[model samples]
Target: MQPLIDEARTFPARAAAHGVNLGPHTTSATPQAMFIACSDAHVVPALITGSRPGDLYELRTYGGRISPYTEHEPTSEAQTIEHAVDVLCVTDIIVCGHSRCGVIDALHPDSEAAPFHLAAGHWHTLMQFDALSAYPCVQARLSDRTLRLHAWFYDIDAGTTARYDPRASTFLPL
Candidate 1:
């Protein structure tokens, strides 16, 4: 409560002095690209990608993991992707993954066999299976000439960004 109050008081002053608009009234008209990023507090999609409010149409996931492309499930990520592509018509779609992700850590082979929550356990299990064999499973759904799907690994500790290029079979620094 104290921290929130402090920030509320200080942010406006800082923004005003810096000539930055801190108000929430401005509306974003249109977005150029669709950014898919993790919901980790450490992972700020706009800050990481240097995007402004209206520049990117962002979709955040637990670990930025997308399940197999399926439109059957009502709340499936497929709907989000389809909307971003077909509806929003975003020219680029970036799927960003970070190192030491909690979701990934949870899905690690050594993690507990049975999670406390069944739904969470099932989701992590699905991610583990997809991440282990990321080659074809991830590639099959994301491989498209018109819409580019980028798999990026952001290393928080090292402050490095690696893009996976399946053709070259390497993680090149960006």
Candidate 2:
């Protein structure tokens, strides 16, 4: 922890020396796109998109699921989406899934054993992929054409990326 903290403490000076200035962005925030990606340490949206600081509004979740919005009890995910769209006015929303995903593996219907060694608990709710497209906020945004939704899959082992094509209902190489 100390080593990581020490490195973090030195990062500002190192970044400054390399001409990385975050001062301008500190006063204002205007990200062009909203990137919803898996909460995998290896799958960094900024690194993947070659984006600089404040270039992307990121929303990371297990399995990259865009959970359905519930008005009675709005989730953090829903709130983030609302802010990204209503406030930031981001035009693009990308949901990126990855290969060797533990969440996906856990949600697999054919798996004989439990995905995790621990208790199921809230993890069971993560299996609801069918409800992803039914989120009210997503529907509204799509209907109004204010935002364009994208689905992507990243293969870690192969170092490949595939984009979902709705017309053909298939994922094609990008």
How much lDDT does candidate 1 score?
Answer: 0.62
Model 1 Cα lDDT, one tens digit per residue, 70-141: 435534566666666666666666666776677756656454643433334334433533542343323443
Clashes of 2: 0
* Candidate models: Cα lDDT each: 0.62, 0.71
Model 1 TM-score on a 0 to 1 scale = 0.65
Model 1 residue pairs with clashes: none
lDDT of 2 by residue, 89-125 (tens): 8888777777767775655545564443212312322
TM-score, every prediction: 0.65, 0.78
User: Which candidate ranks first by lDDT, i.e. highest?
Assistant: 2
Instruction: Tell me each candidate's RMSD, in Å, in order.
Output: 7.2, 5.5
Model 1 alpha-carbon drift over 4 Å, by segment: 5-29, 109-145
